[model samples]
Target: MSKTVRIPRRSRAGILAAIILGICLLLLLTVGVLTVGAADAHPPRLVDNAGLLSQAEADSLRATLDQYSEELNFDIVVVTTNTLDGKTPRDYADDYFDYNGYGYGANRDGALFLRYINGSSKEVWLSTSGEGIKAIRDADIESIFDDMEDDIRANRYGAAFQIFAQDVRDEVLDYRSYDTIWIFVGLAVGLGVGLIATNAMRSSLKSVRQQRYAGSYIKGNSVNITEARDIFLYRTVSRVAKPKESSGGGSSTHTSSSGRSHGGGGRSM
Candidate 1:
């Protein structure tokens, strides 16, 4: 005979309570770690060192950048300065993005729009990283600058920054859409070539003539039909709209001062 040791009911309840508490604590710790990691992913997106924007305007622009960054899963930043610290527009923008830790993901996926105001001369540079390099092409960067050119000239800093943020979001989201347009264009060209070849083959067949009725296929008095009926079958029609032209040329990249590859363009205002 063997005697079995049983755990008391209160002890079992206490053990269950402790396990539940431990799980809750573990979940809290995990959430906290994730929060900290997210915060470290990208630094402050808007740095108006030149004081180009008012307090209210800065807040608004920052909010817009934050919103777009979250939606695109890529950092969008704006920086303004009175001087570039003796570096060229491109070098300054690239260095700012790299040294300030202002990007997301391992590859530092982000875009930094830098406005360097020196006296009356204004220069802007767009610096792209990781996925931003592919999403924003040279032509796309030019278009973005065009969109902000008028606003910036008019001293509408807030409006210009908003446009920059919106355009960046649009370009990133529609980057693959440009490729789709090319696919459509290729399909249309192939279809046209196919039709032309088929027409040429048909034209070469001189022995085949157009027949007005089914009776032309049968020999004279060889077959007679007692009754004839026409039945309707389903018909399918497919239509593809023509693809609109896209202005996306392609991304051009260069090695930044940090040895990291980047793609972008610059404009003078």
Candidate 2:
């Protein structure tokens, strides 16, 4: 006898693997969309500058911030405040960063006094840090703004704005890196939502299909039913055809096997 080789059939396993792979891909896609979607903060952050921007300027900046928001998926709030009279970084502990929520200064522990000017699509600044244009980190952004407070108070608005804008541009150029956990969470939430929705839809369709398949078959059957007969006495009908009648010169009579006769029989005399 010759031995024959058969490629062991693995079709079922292959199909199962394909289905799992498809589901995983779908889940990943959902996560990616959620991870990269726009964030909550658009232009005009600081939450306090709500009413300061003119309609035209606010509209333009809003558009710019909106673009950034979509890209970074984070909100960046902005605020502009005047310096307190006779205040300097050395005068007293500053609360500018404290009030703004950026956190207290990292190096100086004091607010820098500078002037703020205009902002564009990506940046907001007052002046150089005096040491160097240390990339516009959010923590330092606040200090830069506080530093400009003095220039603004002195009515050097143009110079103040130039420094502010320059720093902002640098900060944006150095977009911040985010925590990896947030990315994973975003993907998890998206995948969960997709799976739930897909399962619900599949369940509904399965029920409908079952109903359709069941409806295709028809039943044809017959059954024998039992019948009943009733019997009673006195004033009630006891037989199918029982009556009194005359036959010839006699009242109608009938004879049964037991020799019982009714009134419809003929008599001899």
Candidate 3:
């Protein structure tokens, strides 16, 4: 026969409270770990997967990108990879961005520059999402690529990347200042209109003077009159067809492997 030992009422209550506290602490720790892990997985800017950059180079680039991205309220990502994992430059770039969750704001406004170096098939791909697509137009991107082409061809990888970053920063900033740009345009238009009106008024005054002179039917002391003559050596007329202004500008978009829409363009160097 065994006798059961009964715990005190206060002791049981204390034990229950201790267990509850322990569970709460465990839950908090798990949450903390998860949050940190997520942050680590998604770097805000540069992702040098190819291990091409030295530690110092990577750190500096990452720092610069962080500051620039924050200022623009957009994510500018640079990814370098030796192999595109059997995907084309554009597809890899888009998937890398979408999968890793890089971007800012609700629409994930961001841009990506992917350097794919697979033996002789090296290339750079630029992709944009959300507002980023609107910020950098296709023509603007081509121009930037042209600027970096020489550096890339010379194997100056770091310099080429830096140029890319700088150009993107400039283009994005210019896009943001559209309002100020429009203001300047408006002022220019107003000035042109004013000039045209003033010229017309001067022409009218000249016409009135001519009419007065015609009414006289005689030469004034200040005027020299000669026999009227018509010289028709040649008759010439000019016509200029107005240019059809293009209404198209901005990145061309497509659906990525991850099913997210992206705008981008790419070229080989």
Q: Which candidate number would show the highest TM-score if scored against the true structure?
A: 1
Q: Order the candidates by lDDT, highest first — what do you get?
A: 1, 3, 2
- Please write out the lDDT profile of model 1 over residues 1-269, one tens digit for every residue: 99999999999999999999999999999999999998767678999999999999999999999998987789999999998888999999999999998777899999999999988778999999998998898988999999999999999999999999999999888976877898999999999999999999998998999899988988998887899999989999999999864435777788888899888899789
Better of 2 and 3 by lDDT: 3
Flag regions of model 1 displaced more than 4 Å. Answer: 1-27, 30-41, 103-107, 184-251
TM-scores for all candidates: the values are 0.65, 0.27, 0.62
Model 3 lowest lDDT segment of ten: 206-215
Candidate 2's TM-score reads 0.27
Candidate 3 residue spans exceeding 4 A from truth? 1-41, 179-247
As a TM-score, model 1 comes out at 0.65
lDDT at position 248, candidate 1: 58
How high is the CA lDDT of each candidate model? 0.91, 0.41, 0.84
- lDDT for 125 in candidate 3 is 92
After TM-score superposition, what is the CA distance of residue 194 in candidate 3 from its true location, in Å?
17
**Clashes per candidate, residues 3 or more apart or on different chains:** 0, 28, 0
For candidate 2, give the lDDT of residue 137: 36
